[model samples]
Target: MPDSTAPLLLKGYAWLPDLRRRAHDVPAVPVRLLGKRGTALHGKEAVDFFYDEKHVRRHDAMPGPVLDTLFGRGAVHTLDGEAHRARKALFLDTLKDPARVAALARKAQEEWDRAEADWRGRDRVVLFHESARVLTRAVHDWAGVPLPADEEEATARDLVAMVDGFATVGPRHVRARLARKRQEGRLARLIGELRSAGLPPEPEHATIARAVAAHVDADGRRLDPHTAAVELLNVLRPTVAVSWFLTFSAHALHRWPEHRALLAADERHAWGFAQEVRRFYPFAPFTGGLAATDTEWGGVTIPEGSLVLLDLYGHDHDPDLWPDPYSFDPARFTREGVVIGRDDLVPQGGGDPAAGHRCPGEDITLALLAALVPRLARLPHEVPDQDLSIPLSRVPTLPRSGYVMERVRAEAPAPVG
Candidate 1:
């Protein structure tokens, strides 16, 4: 075990890459004990901490941006342990079976069709942030009613601005608080509209919305519209952020004509490919889990009540687990490679994590991606830089100057077949 007194580096998830640690570093996950935080932060070293009870119990110990002063405490992330688990479970119930995924895919196709038509025979279209806005509309539409374009656009803009502040990772994020306050005013106006308009019919469309409509807590009361609005806005962060993943993956296949063949060779191929794309280009490489109780893990001790960040990107790319840490390997998910999760093991809060706060939109994202990847491929087009790896700096970059390529229009339907 390393000495407990060793000077510990407190690099948030942002600095993981600079440290040169990948998925397979240290024989197992590192459970760095900062002084007295040994027993409280258990599972930091578990071969699979995703499912470890100790890990789940250390909820508040994880790091996260504080909520706005106006809202106080609302969502599961703001609450710890039992309260979080209970609330999260209720929200998760809506995604237990994600049939809405297909609808969202169809919706995505419709939006793309519209966008393409608007291209007006232009060979390329610059798209990055626009793709996310498109998905937001789909998600919102799936929940019940199509959002007014203006409202949807406003929310998407606010979400991006707020998150930009968090990514700053320090005093800068604090500076962003004022901007966040102003944005909240706009959000309040939107919520007022939703409340007066009534919730829509898309039950499984989004967990928070669905829960607000269907859930009855121990008190047997559903969420008020204001609380519902806060939760709803929170969901947008991951959903739209995922837009980057979808765009990056599309960017990869479009650039590398060979990948189009790979995508075509098998229809069932996209799921695994998508997973790898997520792992390969993890937008948010790491997240923190605070130690609620003192815990000992991986032969190291972490004192109680300490903040610990997990280097998901580092661990995913660790040399021990990945032969070439920097190389992009989509098939790493095969039975041989490390699978971060299973039904029994759940460490992370988002998708693949335990039942507690799994990303409800996992299916929504997959289905939308599945349709988009194949459709773009089946059609004909070529764009320069289609194969270029996403640059290190484009937090979520895609071909914005437009995909410079010609379309291979689909052949007219055969006379009989």
Candidate 2:
């Protein structure tokens, strides 16, 4: 099989699906990535196979560059077995609390309301950049991190850079490395302070940072300050990354204006709209792990230690799974009696989040979007003439213009009957 690392880098999100198309739509497409023989799998059954711990493992699966840029070194993303479970428990406890999720969503809505007022006075605002800052401020407040107002934009940029640069070897990649280094250092210092002085009493709600700072691993050792900082970023960075989906939501509304009225009128439709945006937009192209042992799937043998990739983007866009997959149709999700199977949506990875390698922050992603999308729909703005083209060659790509809007105004309140 031909090496696909170059193609993947050059083609970005189009690489795997194109490969599958060329290969007569094989269930398992053989290829080489990073000089290692890898097999790519898709669909619901593939999700079950890929997430099974006995078949695949995450330890040593993520590349070093990805670790340095996206997930910090020793972050929970790289752990496996008992260590994985123990570390994952921290996220489940912090993120899975309905009260905590609701509180964060409420904070985000408040932040959006405040930001909307500021945007109204401006001639033009880039929704992507502004939404990122809004998310950063809200998550920081929720996480109990005292971010000075002056530093909020810079901090948000660093968080965005980390996600933006992880997949490429360019200036973006260098910026990502520097951002991670700076953030890890700053957070480590904060963790040290919290450890020594203990958490403050002002924030009655439980803070994720405080929980991570005090969490003991399966080995009965508290995470070192650096590791604790990494875990903290694991919470902070991904929450801020929700800005990407928010931006995509704006793009969707612009392209399909009819959905806006429905989304604004009904919160359920807004949630459905968020799910469709997550599915339609290219986020994570694929996720992979090393084969734990010899495994067979779709009549192909995956040797022990070989890389096994789940085709996330491809699966979401597969016509067999999503009829007219390319269409930006939120109704596919909002239709009455509709149910989204766990494995059917792999935008953030699939399978059981608590028991598997799937992102635990998935619920928070949905909640933040559910709260923010309707607000975006109700916000009055006009899409400016700019470069809206999303380049497929760039990993974690977005509209070149960052979805600019002009003459922003908040929605008018309904009059009493």
| Predicted model with the maximum lDDT | 2
What residue runs in model 1 are displaced by over 4 Å at the alpha carbon? 1-14, 17-24, 27-73, 120-124, 169-210, 218-221, 323-325, 331-354, 379-417
After the best TM-score superposition of candidate 1, give how far the Cα of residue 258 lies from its true spot, in angstroms.
Answer: 0.9
Per-residue lDDT of model 1, residues 156-202, tens digit only: 55555555455444554664465456544544465566556665565
- Please give, for residues 1-417, the per-residue lDDT of candidate 2 as tens digits: 778889999999999999899988989988799899989997789999999999999899999999999998998888899999999999998888889999999999999999999999999999999999999999999998879999999999999999999999989999999999999999999888887887655323457788877888999998999999999999999999998999888888888889878976788887788899999999999998999999799878999999999999999998888999999888898788878788888899998988988999988999999999988988888886898788988899998889999999878887789
Best by TM-score: 2
In model 2, state the lDDT of residue 292. 94
Give the poorly placed runs of model 2, Cα more than 4 Å off.
Answer: 199-205
Clashes of each: 36, 0
TM per prediction: 0.73, 0.97
